[model samples]
Target chain A: MAHADMDTQRLDLPEPMPQPRFQAGFITPYAFIFPALLVMLGGLLYPVFMAMYLSLYDWQIGLDLEDAPFVGLTNFSRMLTDPQVWEVLWVTMRFGFWTITIEMTLGVALALLLEKPIRGASVFRTIFILPLMVSPVVVGLIWRYLFDARVGWINYYLGAWFGIEPQIWLGDAQLAFFAIVFTDIWQWTPFIFIIVIAGLQALPSEVVEASTIDGANWWQQVFLVKLPMIKSILVIALLMRLIDVFRGMEVMLIMTGGGPGRSTELLSLHIYNRAFETQQLGYASAISVLLIVIVFAISTLILTMANPMKSRSDV
Target chain B: MTGLFKKGVGALAALTMSTTLAFANPYEKYEGTTIVVSWPALSHFIKAEELIEEFTEETGIEVEVDALQYLKLRDRQLLEMSKDEGEYDVVSWVVMWKGEYVSKGLLTPLSQFYTNGSLVDPNYDINDIADAYLQNGGIVGGHKGYMPGKSGAMYGVPFGAETSILAYRKDIFEEQGLEVPETYDELRDVMAKLHAAGIPALTSRGKTGHQVTAGWLLHLAPLGGKIFDDNWNPVINSPEAVEAAQVMREVVKTGPAGIPTFGFGEAAAAFLQGEAAMHLDTLKIAAMSRDPKLSKIDGKVGYALHPVGSRCGSETGGFAAGIPANSQNKEAAFLFLQYITSKAGDQRMVELGGDPVRISTLQNNTEGFDEYPVVAEQLPCADPDWRPLIPEWNELNIDVLGQALTQVITTDDPIQPIMDAANEKARAIMEREGYYVWQ
Candidate 1:
């Protein structure tokens, strides 16, 4: 009886049920989509599958793929066993953690602090988001030049004011990692800040008023009311940052070239070196497959944490 | 609201897809079609574009040249080629990609083009190109895989190749009354004198890993040492190599501040800007001297063989180009390949402030720079093949030389400790990489 009722309701809807909105292409629906879909299938899907296939072979970039003897699971096994891969992964995770944590906390806190319509607040907000607007590569180059041991502005100030020796920002292993993290935070915190402000602006005001009515103090209102309401938006901001962290090779590659030792090598940079510089295509592909898996798992975890019921409305 | 959010995400991804797929057809009646030629971001390529109008007039192919530094360019080209898109018909590359690309059937084998005599001018002889330059930039593996086209074959083409030559300020030598140092002892003597004069003799080492590593190896090579032996075994700890290291460590006392973090750009800049009086660099800088825009030294540059430590030799480094085997327009690619690497192209490049590898271009009596003394004097012995012709050299470089050279300049650590660490690490890398290890 329930099913029949649902079917009757469906029939009562608009004629042809709006022709299945966003349908795949050809003739009835835009035929242009067919060409576009085929392109995606060929360009995106094929590379993905080929990457998986290549992971089974001992492939080199300049060597014949046919000559690459198939060694199923060995490439994956090698990647798993390699200490350097793990080292890079751990460094990347730590990097991601530090940047994301600092950016998110400071970003959200600053957004909340600046939400008041104070004098010159608009100017401060504009300037805060400006860093986000600059291209990441340009930001990297600017920072790299500023941090140069000999000619950098940072060292100049440090030397002139503090009587400190000019530090090798990108030449020391630990320093390079910190330098990249610092650069990333400097450029990207604004992204988190802007998103948080937007989230704050759209939030309903009645809840805060109601919390006040319940005798909640400022901290109480923020912790017990506003934060819960914005929890979902926070997840979205986290998702974007996590993705950027995984794939941001440009700044790191340009700034440090994954050097002073492999100390600053993020997974993406490592994959780049393996695929091109070292010419180990199969190994790089395998590494990327694992990366995709890791990213997917993390996203899933974050999504689940954000939405307990897996409900779309939570985000 | 839910539908809107999903649509927005879908639309953004779709937008990214459309742009990437939107490669302009090069043969589109010579109108809006744009062909992207990927290359190293070195100013040399940009310098050549000043003459691109001539190419456009002759061929009617609208060109949009894009460049990135070579390492990133290599990464981008590899990733892009693996997709098998016909987006770029021509891309700048080094010889390393030839073996892999040819075997994977991703690079065009230039043999057929040469056999037919249709792609290249018939007057071009196979021997016109120096054998050393061709071998260094030729096919990587023991396969007839890819040709860079201009050197009488077409899988790829030479893009203004030049060997690494030691560079120093002529005025420095004259002021100090030092003859251009050719041997290690002479270089040491010069360094000792400069140290006594307190002008910071050697350019900083360990600035950028590759920059420091590259020059240092060339410095060490003339000492009759190499990072690896013929079997790809790591033998950098040879007595000659150690002696080379010891001298480098001592010479580095005269290195500039922050020596650990300097790159070729800084090192060369220091030399050219008259900050560092002596620098071992490349012959391509010869173009820099005569050009008013690039020259920091006005009539103050002098050149010689990279100082010989034990006298094996200096190294060669330059750019090469390859046509993907799976390119949709193979014939068009070959034609562009030949055009770019042709004697005319090379000569024009030199005219446009580029370094030329071809003797014919160097010997071009018509060009204005031929009157410059360095151009005439240095062209004869500018041989390449100083860097070994091995596909594995790139790895050997990053693992072996890249690591050690950084240490050689940074710490006051003994040369023996650093060389030992490098040798041990290098051997394991070679063995693990499936090379013939000297047990």
Candidate 2:
């Protein structure tokens, strides 16, 4: 009887007033986002615009900016034929290819193998990511010392264990390239591993369990179901790593200084040397513009193909 | 409220007047002002910092030293000067940058400062500085703009002077019954003997760009190889240069296994650790080699003039401190420069493992001079233009010439072709910079 009386009182109450619609005017949403927009404009767009403008001028170090002569598109035209630019680009591609491939393969394999909760898993994870925590310059210095022919532990151990002669790891072109690649793998593979492991742990237990019960082995389940399910995550991780390759240069700069003959110079480092070392600020800016376009185009292609947002929508 | 405000204003005025009265001297006028100095992380800078307290105590001024890597310091100065921010009151510059800095009007002319009796110390004898360092490093474009001596405006004061010298193990030379090498051919023979005696013969800088280029210039200049002739034509591919290149390649075979990648630090380490019998490098390393804490051959190292090829001289390179034109405290900065490069300051620097620019310091019959007598002996034989004084020299020498040297050392390719290609590129760069009008 009490429940009936409460229901009658609720029905007798006036129908709830219609909820107010969000009155987002044209300026209100922008007002809320103005701070973020301002930050992006200052930090990102301003530099891009400045680089584009500077690329058109023939400026050099120690000269006042106003004294710089305006040369329309000459820097770009020169860059088109610059053999050094092409050589560095080729090196960047080759380095990225080897490092990314090895990192992805090793990262994913390790993640799968260690996906199960095991003793000391946290400790192993900490050790794996320690390289990523180190400063790039410090990493370069450590590796430089390690690769020293006269005093390096690497040469010492190699000689002691395998009876191999001491090698000049940074002096030779092929070896220097290998050294930088191996260093990148050491530092970044853990990033991929961490990401893949997160994705693996987040997988629905019911589907994986059902796959296991359906007579699918571990490798089969990972390849046919689990990996396919986390395809978008893999794509995002790959794109982020690809961007890192173009942006990264401090390690190479400190280790090889882009050379035993431009052997280890990435495009970014070449731009730096041109600007500071050669004092060709305008030419460096022109090269920087090229680097930006290349990176932007590649990023756009990856995002368009993978379309992580589309995958979310499908889910 | 008005009575209190009147009392406050009166007290402030009285305090200001008393402060002004206390600092009546011109040098003390800049009292309480703090000046910033940007310099390379060299031992000289440490010595300067240690002695700066004396300046502060005398003038009632304070100084902050920003020690940075050599390259970083150069870039910072360029950036700061270009922006006209007055971030650095004093800038320490390499000799190679004198032409560039002066041409850009980045450094102030010190003639007026020298004339100002209050700013210039009476006992700070400008003539006491070595003539070679004064003329080559302190003066630019015939302007005695830095450490002026009866000539054009002085632009900088020579603080550290380095001339290339040959350092070898004295015991090893005696054991092999060899005298100091007097010529390139003799050097080759000595090296051969050392190698056969089962000792690493020589170590030199082979890292690409500046290190290799600087090392090669030490060889090239003494061999009569010129970067350009009077006609401004690139002549780095000359037969003399090729011979120097060949000698460099041959010499490395007897050096440490990674001589091709060795920089000055590595080469110096190899020599100081007694792993190599000889090292051809700047005299600055000679100072370090004599430090017992840092060297295994501290007492056994012998210094000699660089081996002569077709010519009989060595390359001179070092750092100098200059007042940037954009500095707000130009007078105070000039005082600081004079203090550090002064006779007493240079002696103190010598004691602290820095190369000396003062003749008195070099001539002093002290233990420091006795240990490195060859430094003073070689100063007279330094070739000022061995590295050239053009603004574009760093680029041409490192990118073109150094790149060529790197290729020759790293690969089995013939030296002539690589040198010719480098010359072609160098000529193009020079032409583009409007440095040459003749084809």
Candidate 3:
């Protein structure tokens, strides 16, 4: 057998046989993905398209869609000059900035603190994620109760523990804005904490150990090695929250109803008020188109930063 | 023998006719038909729901009620009525929304049903319902800004009518030697004294949107403020309106610490929980004030008519029931409406914590009337045209005036500029809605 193998190796091998370009039916791949594509079209694209379509008409509530007068681009042009729209857009941006900044910072710090197995760590982790489990509407109510100017636990403790005067947390515009921001942080930090901690725990221990052996300090290890490795996860979490900031309005709607001169009125809540409160369905749809574009641009910009096709080692 | 037979046959025929007429059932034709009613989830509606089984048994018609939040009912009704096949057989008509609904041809004129002897109960006297509530709930095509005018058509039946009244802590008033204020000046003085004494004086809704406007509009008519003049020009910044605004500011400033953020719930809580001295709002709050389970100062609460400003005027409007034009079960729906608004039905509602729009029911139901005698007294003062019931009112009252009222209550910004800006905005809305087409 050895002699035969040596003889065969000495001879040149024939050129490889040509392979067929197609192995299966052309429709098979598309068939596999048809359901998902259909879902995206139905669930995501359809509503957006409908909003754009509705934006072209001068529609009021109780009017048939077919009977609605077509005032092409008028609704869009009106929204451009609507002060309320601009005010609420600015409010949403400010809200997004404060909430995302604090939530990311606090969430990462908490995840890092509890990623290791420590005494009562599980209990603390459980308690931290409890706020995430609560419904957003319920969270709004709970926080509204806490922030009540009179007979609230927050005021009571602030006075009892310190000698501070009670304040109407939801009355003043600035204070109301701050109150909504604080509530968002309390409810959402846990979400970020859960995601970040999962990412942290899943990290390869060998690289961390190597960093430790190379005499890198704890802060250096976190900043240079650990955080850099989880940058993609952090960006994704942030993008999710940023989109949420644009989309969510239940908390603000319940807490302030965009009160004290529209100070706490987020963009989504403003859209709601425009549509239902004012019965300007067409104008509201136009504003909603603006929201979709803003969210799309934000998501695109953030996704580019993450480079999902590349691995951490490639970075 | 022939004469005796003829007399006997005539006698038998007359006897059978009289018996059949006496025992006729008005609800027989609608039996087995099911209707869907969209109503607000208020206290009275919940209680009225318990009596629906009896209605079903008597008529053999099924009722499927969708009890939604009071504010949400309109949105639901609007969408439902817009559809080719309406989801609700009977929809609630908030008084302010009647203009839009009637003008848009969404509701059936109930006069058609009332004129049908076979459909309407003979004993169901529409006149028994209080004129103020009936006019506000039923009439349409009246002069602009006026609800009941020279002539109109009936479109709905008032099921849950209400008016603004004052609820005060009797214990506190007696202790402070405060008399029941009968005028705006007296009320302001009383509130100031109560505030100066370190007590939360007045509790009223100040949250933005319909709530704030509803609270402030209570003073608008009494203070001689009109949203528009005869020429359809915006008059919200008139001197009387400015005074009303001032009165509103004082009420909020001197009230509980969280008054600026108070909705109906918070305002009612402030009074019911013994945190405030007085509350001037819906009669439902007064009714709830007497419930021991709900109110901390239940027995100690006293009710009074709203104080007079320029002239006596109180906020009057509430839920009414009407069949949508597209409703599939219109006959059944109309029968259900007539049944629930009959004298017996109104009395049952009054017994079950509901306000009555019927004069006979209000007079007859004296068993638990001592707690809220102001309900009767305030009826005459509740001007049906208190707020303009135009299609543009929703935007003007809620988005424009509501925000202005919030600004007034929350900030020290000069009231004149805020009100003038509100007036300008109102003018813009009115003009856009074609109110000033002549101009």
- DockQ ranking, best first: 3, 2, 1
Residue range with the least summed lDDT across 10 consecutive positions in model 3 chain A: A306-315
Better of 1 and 3 by TM-score: 3
Best candidate per lDDT, number?
A: 3
Tens digits of per-residue lDDT for model 3, A1-315: 998998898765776778768657877999989999999999999999999999999889888888899999999888998888888999999999999999999999999999999999999999999999999899889988999998789889999999889989998889999999999999999999999999999999999999999999999999999998898889889989999999999999888888777899999999998898888899999999999999999899877767544655575
Best prediction by TM-score: 3
| DockQ of the two-chain complex in candidate 1 | 0.18
- Model 1 lDDT on a 0 to 1 scale: 0.70
What lDDT score belongs to each candidate, Candidate 1 first? 0.70, 0.84, 0.87
Docking class of 2: acceptable
- The parts of candidate 3 lying over 4 Å away from their true place are A1-22, A25-27, A306-308, A311-315, B1-23, B371-373
Question: How close is every model to the real structure, measured as TM-score?
Answer: 0.74, 0.90, 0.93
The predicted structure with the larger DockQ, 1 or 3, is 3
TM-score between candidate 3 and the true structure:
0.93
Candidate 2: lDDT of A80? 95
Q: Name the lDDT of candidate 2.
A: 0.84
Residue-by-residue lDDT tens digits, candidate 2, B30-75 = 8888899988887667766767888788777799988998878777
